[model samples]
Target chain A: MKALEQKILTDGIVLSDTILKVDTFLNHQMDPLLMKQIGEEFAARFQHKEITKVLTIESSGIAPAIMAALQLEVPMIFARKRKSLTLQDGLLTSNVYSFTKQEETEISVAKKFLTEDDHILIIDDFLANGQAALGLLHIVEQAGATAAGIGIVIEKAFQDGGERLRERGIQVESLARIESLQDGKVQFVKETRRVEV
Target chain B: MKALEQKILTDGIVLSDTILKVDTFLNHQMDPLLMKQIGEEFAARFQHKEITKVLTIESSGIAPAIMAALQLEVPMIFARKRKSLTLQDGLLTSNVYSFTKQEETEISVAKKFLTEDDHILIIDDFLANGQAALGLLHIVEQAGATAAGIGIVIEKAFQDGGERLRERGIQVESLARIESLQDGKVQFVKETRRVEV
Candidate 1:
């Protein structure tokens, strides 16, 4: 978590007051070594949970999710942002709102992957509005599976996504929690609260 | 590679004569253990190349790319299907025609990641029409980087993508090469030809 926070401060670009882009390390251009460490961190946090599968959205979340799946020794399922030609008809679909894009998109997962017996852990790169997490949770619910927990690499604490999900009693664990990113300076939540999750 | 072929034969759903769905393990619902093996195979194949970075397109390609990067101990970069809110303005963009989606989408990568000094090896989930590979090659060219090789998980030999890229003098190593899928009976190109490339 410290490595991630420090990397964010060093390599991450703050395009605007609200947007913290860690694409250099986490998303667009991925540091696989760092990713493995981050994944291990998530695995360590959710060590007690009996995770049958890890769920995520396509694109950015795939790397961390895959890494976490590696550490957790579980299979990972990424929800397709759009239905492709290869994907079949029977799917668990949910509408997710992207705060950055300000548009709602229907994300779907193949129904065969998730089942009632599965204990699913939702993972993603960024947790801004929690819309994507909610969508994944919806798909997990649709499959009648248990939502064991949610693991996020970076969560904007100033945003209500983390708070709202926590208030909902969902066990959300994030490696880097951004307290504020105002006036081009990034601020993080104190490290003392890292173990409370 | 044999394991990948075996997985395809066992879990792959042949939707039609031309379409082979490998979402069960290779893409959608990814088996991390298998992915790691596939990644190691790629790394072993490209062991000679001094690859500074690994590249791929987002969504389905991210997992294999990440795995290969892990094996190679290098950073991986995924070209965005659409420029997200986090991505910047100075991007290397390419127009890729998706046969699956039946549409042309602009894929972009951050210019900062790819450089003239870098040696790039492109990784992808599938090599069908070679449009995505061509697009990625174009980005590498734009960066003035050396395209060391291409590593594909599955190459449909029936399609022109693999042939075209190989004809262009690019090194392409595919784990599984399907020669024919006529009448739902999958036929390989023969395992003897695996070592030629």
Candidate 2:
């Protein structure tokens, strides 16, 4: 988490009060070494839970999900943003509203991939409004699977998404939580719940 | 290579004459162990080349690209399908025609991520019509970067993509090459060239 926090402070750019661009090392351009460490941290944190699968949305989430899956030694299922012709007809779909794109889009996972016997850990690059995480949670619920935990690289703590999920008693863990991004400066939450080193 | 070839024969679904779905292990639902082996295989194959960075498209390609980057201990850069508001204005963009979607979409990478001194190895899940690879190659050209090699998980030999790249003298290494998928039976082309195991 320290490494991730450091990377965010060093390489991440605060485009505006709401948007933080981490294309250099987090999403668009990935740092495999850092991802490995983050993956290890997730595995260490959730090793006690029975995580059968790592679920994530397309594009940004794929890298960290893959790393976490490798660390957990479990299968990773990515929900495609667009329905591909190759995808099967039976699917677990959920509507996601993208604050960045300002569009409502559907994300889905093939029903065949997830099942009631599985415990899924959701992972993603960023959690702002939590629409993406909520959509993934919906899909997991539709499959009758248990939500073991949620792992995120960064969380906009000033936003209500993290608080909302916590209000529902869902276990959410983010590597770095931004307290506020005022005046083009990223502020980290002064206090956080204890996590395993 | 034998491991990958065997995985294809066992788990790969021959969807149609031209479509072979390896989503069970390669894409949508990913097997991390197999992906590790794939990364090892790619590292073995491209060991002689100077690969500064591993390049791939988003979604499907992210896993293998990250795995390969882990093996190579290099940075990985993925081209995003759409430009988000967070993305910088300066980028290397290319138009890619999707066979499945039947549309042309633009892919872009931040200009700072890629450089003329970088030796990029392009990796992808499938090379059907090779449009995606072509688009990635174009991005590399736009960055003035040299492509060290191209590693593909599966290449549809019946399609013109692989031939087109080879015709252009790009070093392409496909783990499994399918000759045809007639009657839902996947047929692999005989391994004519030596592959690092």
Per-candidate TM vs. native? 0.97, 0.96
Q: In candidate 1, what are the lDDT values of residues A38-94, reduced to their tens digit?
A: 889889888899998999998889988988999999999999998887775899999
**Candidate 1 clashing pairs?**
none
C-alpha RMSD of each candidate structure in angstroms: 1.4, 2.2
The per-prediction tally of clashing pairs is: 0, 0
lDDT of 2 by residue, B131-195 (tens): 99999999999999998899998888899999888878778999888899999998888874534
Give the CAPRI rating of model 2: high
Query: By TM-score, who's the top model here?
Result: 1
Model 2 ranges with Cα > 4 A deviation: A192-197, B192-197
Error of 1 at B94 (Å): 1.0
Interface RMSD of 1: 1.1
User: What do the candidate models score in CA lDDT, each in turn?
Assistant: 0.89, 0.89
Question: What does candidate 2's lDDT look like per residue over A85-105, in tens digits?
Answer: 888599899999998998999
For candidate 2 chain B, the 10 contiguous residues with the lowest summed lDDT are B188-197
lDDT of 1 at B193: 42
Q: Residue by residue across B1-197, what tens digits does model 1's lDDT show?
A: 78888889999878787889888887799998898898898898898999999999988788888889998999999999887765658999999998888999999999989999999999999988999999999999999999999999999989999988998877899989999988897788887345544
